[model samples]
Target: MTTDCSSVAYFSMEIALDPALPTYSGGLGVLAGDMLRAAADLGVSMVGIALVQRKGYFDQHLDDLGNQSESPTAWEPEKVVEPMLPVVTVRIEGRDVRVRAWRFLIKGLGGHVVPVYLLDTALPENSPWEQKLTDSLYGGDAHYRLCQEMVLGLGGVAILPELGHSLISSYHMNEGHSALLTLGLLEERLEGRALSSATEEDIHAIRAKCVFTTHTPVPAGQDQFPHDLVSRVLGEERTAALEVTGACPAGSLNMTYLALFGSRYINGVAMQHGEVSRGMFPNYPIRAITNGVHAVTWMSPAFGDLFDRHIPEWRHDNLYLRYAIGIGTSEIREAHVQAKRRMVAELKQRTGVQLDEKVLTIGFARRAATYKRADLIFRNLDRLRWIATHCGPIQIVFGGKAHPSDVGGKDLIRRIFESAAALKDVIKVVYIENYDWRVAPLLYAGADLWLNTPQRPQEASGTSGMKAALNGVPSFSVMDGWWVEGCLEGITGWAIGHGPESPDDEVFEIAALYDKLEMIILPMFYGRPTAYAEVMRSAIAINGSFFNTQRMLSQYLANAYFRPAVA
Candidate 1:
C-alpha cells in the first residue's frame, strides 16, 4: 500500500519482517522476507503480499529433557503493523468472509524501503469461526486449511488493486499455498467477460503474468484437497474453472499441480531440487534458482563492522564480499572471537550454560525435520567421545523447533537431549528453547563451524549455512541443497555424506559426519588455526558473496519479473 507504482507482487504464506512478528514459520518465510529486502536494495518496484498469521507458527517450548509443547503465540496487528483501508471479502464455504490488510515496511541497503502487506480476516463483521480463520497458522483440520488459503490467495488478489497495485504485471508465488492467486488472476484477466467463456488463451495470459517456486521436495509436504472439500470451499463454478485451467485434475486439487499448471516460469530452490522436482512432475520445466540470505540482515556486528572497515561496498553489493579473500586471516579470527564471546555470554545468561569460547563449537539449528537428521552427529557416541578426547575439546550448540504434528521430528529432539545427557561432561551440548529469528544470528556467527546433515535430496536449498558463510563460519554439511553448489571441499567448508546419489544409507552418512569431525574439522581448528581461518575467509569471499538474496533477486528480475511475457 505504501508504493502505488509497484509493478511486481510477490506472494508467500508468510514473511519474516520483524522478530516480534511471528507470521513466518521457518525457511520459506525467511527466504520470502530476504527476497523482499533485496528487492528494495536493488531498487525494484516490488510489493509483497502474505497472510497475517495472528498466532504465528506457535511459540516452541522445550522442557528440560527436550520434550516439546506448543501454545498459541498471538501478536496484536495494531501493535506492529499499520492498518490499511481496503477491506475485501473472500467467499468460503458459501459465506462471504470479510478481509482487511496491514502494512509493514522493510528497510534495505541505503535505507530503501519495500512494503509488505499482511492480509487479515479477523474482522468483527464476520462470523465467530470466520473471525478466527486467520487466528493461527497451520492450525485446525483440512477444512480450516482450505479456508485459510482462500483468504490468503483469493483475498490477496482482490485487495491488490484497491491498494493501487492493479498495474502489478507479475505475480511471483513463493510456493503452492498461494497458487490460488492464479485463479484470482484468471478472473481479473476476464475483464468483465463471462466466467464460463474463459478459454485456454485466458489461462495462457494468466500464466504469462505468474511465476512459481516449489519449495517442498517431499510428496506429503505438498497441499492437496479432495474434490468434495474443494467444491465445498470453492463453489462448483470455481472448481469447474480450476478444471478448465488445469489447476485441478479429475481426482483431487493438488496445490503444487495448480501452481505448475498456472505458472509461466517455475523454479526449485536448488539445482538438485529442480532435478528432483522435474522427476516428480515430469511434464513441467522446473528450473533452479538457489536460495540466499539477506547479507545485511544476517551478518553479525563483528563481521559487519569488519566488512565496513575492509569491504565498504559489501552492504550495497553483496558480490563485493568476494573481495573478503584479501582480508587478513587474523582479522577473521578476531571478529569470530568477538562473535563467539557474544554468543557465549547470551547462552550463559539465558540457559545457565557456560561454554568455553576457545572450545571448537559447532552449530546445528533449523526446523527439526526428519530429513534434516539433526542427531546424525551423535550416531556413535563412543566415536564422538574419542574424537573429543584425541582430536580436540569440542562443544555443540543445537536449536530448532518441530511442528506440533510431526511426531518423528519431536522424537528427534528427545534423542538429541539423550545424546547430550550421555556426553554432558565430554561435550557441553545445549539445546536452546523457543528458537526463532532472534536466536538464529548468534549461532550463525558464534560457532566455529556450521553443520547440516539432511537426508539425501530432501533439502530444497538450505540458506542457514549460507547465512553462516556471510559471517565467515564455514559449513560442515551433507552434500545436498545449496551445499552441493557451494561446497569447495576444504576451501569453503568440509562435506559429509557424498553427493545426492551416492547412497541413502544412514550408517554411511553418520560415519562420514564422525570421520570429518574427528579426522578433519577438529584437528584443523585445534592444530592449524591460520589454515582454518583461510577456509572461513573463502566461505565469505566465495559462498557468502554469491549466495545472497541480492543476487537471487537480480536473477528473478531477469528471469521472471521483467521477462518477455511482460514485454
Candidate 2:
C-alpha cells in the first residue's frame, strides 16, 4: 500500500494469473505470471502491472475439418479481484483517456503475498471507443494497438505512484509492449528541463533504475511503429527525443530497441536466444537467463504426494527433487499410474474417447503457429503408422489456439485434423479444443512422452516441457531453446535432431524421429517398462529439480534486480 512496501515494479501487456481469468493467450503472459508467483514465494519486494483484458484473448473452436474460429472469452473479474481507487490518464488521439486498475493477490507456498495490478480503460468517464481499448488482448488495428500500448506503458507508470510505489528501485519491462514506460521514466528525469537540454547523466540516471527482458527472436514477436504513426500517437516531442536517443535506429519506433537503449540490464529469455539477440543488436551487451516453470504448480497431485512422502523438503526447496533419485522406481511407477488413470478418465469424459493408461501416449500442445510445425509428425504418416503398428500402439493428443489474424496457423490446425483422419485406421488421434491452464497438467502428468518441434532459433524458451518433466514425463524434442540445456540424450529425454538450427531437412528429421520411436523409445516403453520408468524418474530428478521458477527468480534477484550500479 506504500512506496517502501514494493521496491520493484514489473510491467507487461498481459499476465496469466488464472485459467478462469483468460487474460492470456499463450506462453508470454503465462511466463509473466510465473515470475510473479515465484517472486511471492521468495518474498521479493515486487509489484506487477498488466492490462485487464475485459473480453480475454479468445475462446477457441475447431470444426470437424479443423477450421478454427474464435469468440470472446467472457468472465466476471469482480468475482476474483478488487478494484483500486487510483485513476490515471494518458494522451490518446490527443484526448485524455482515463485508466483504472483491479488488484489480484497471489499467495505463495510460504504464505507470503504479492499484489498484481491489471490496468483497465473501461471507465464510465472515458468515451465508448476509449472504454474498449483494453477490452481485448492483442486486438484491433495499428491505431488501436498503439493506443492500447499507451494505456499499458504510460498509464501504468502514472498509476504506480498513485498506488504508492514511488520508492520503486527498479522498473522491469517484461517485453517490448511495455517499452514506452521508458519514455515515462524519461519525463520524470527531465523534470522541467527540455528534452534537448537533458544531459548524458540524465539518461544514464534513468537507465540505472531499469531492467528489461526480450522474449523471442521472431519478428512478429517484436513491436515496431512507423515514424508517421508514432508522431500521431506519441506526438512530435517524444518522437524527437526517441530519434535523438538512437531508439528509433530503423526509422521506426522499435519497442525492443527502445527498452534496450533505456535499460542498464537487458537479457534474452534463453541462452541461445541471448546469442541470437546479441547478433540482432551487435552493439548491445545482452545476457542470457534461461526460462523455467513453477515446479509446485506443474507437479501432478500424485507426484506431489509421492514427493511429500519421500522428500518432504521439496515443497520448500525444489532442489530437494534431486533426492528423487533415491525414491523407489516402483513408487515412481505407481504414482505415474495414479496420475495417468485420472488423465485417461478425463479424456473419456470430455471427448468421449476412451484412453488406456497402459497405452503409449504422445502429446504436442502449443499455439498452432506454422513455424511450430504442429503437423510435423504427420509429415510422413506411413513411417508413423509402421512404427505404431509394428513396435507399439500409440495415441497422440493435440491442443492450442491460433492468433485471430494468422491464416497459416489456422490452416495448421486443419492440417492436423486431416492427418488424424488419414491415420485413424492405425493411430488414434484427438485434438482438444480451447486448451488452457486448467488442461495443461492433465496431459503433462498422463502422457507417456511430451513432444516439441519448433523451427530452430525461433523458440526463445519452452516452459511446457519443463512442466512435463515435473510430472515425470520426458521430452522428445529438437535441440533448441531451453531443450539444449535440458536434454541429456535418453537420460532426461530424447532429441529429435542432432544439431542446433539444423537445416530444414524435414525428411531427415522425420526419419530420425520415427527411427528413435520404432527402435528405442517404443521398445523400451512397451517391452522394458522398468528401464523406461528410470527415464521418467531421471526427468523428475535432473530436469524437474533444476528447471523451475524458484531457480529462475534467484537468477533475476542476484543478476538483474539488485545488480551493483556501475561507477
How close to the true structure is residue 267 of candidate 2, measured as C-alpha lDDT? 89
Q: Score candidate 1 by TM-score against the native.
A: 0.98
lDDT of 1 by residue, 106-128 (tens): 87666777889999888889998
TM-score of model number 2: 0.98
> Where does model 2 exceed 4 Å of error?
1-4, 501-504, 565-567
* Clash count per candidate: 0, 0
lDDT per residue for candidate 2 within 428-468, as digits (tens), equals 89898998888888998989899998888788888899999
Displacement of residue 504 (Cα, Å) in model 2 is 4.5
Candidate 1 residue spans exceeding 4 A from truth: 1-3, 191-194, 565-567
For candidate 2, list the clashing residue pairs, or say none. none
Cand. 1 Cα-lDDT: 0.89
* TM-score for all models, in order of appearance: 0.98, 0.98
The 10 consecutive residues of candidate 2 with the worst lDDT sum are 498-507
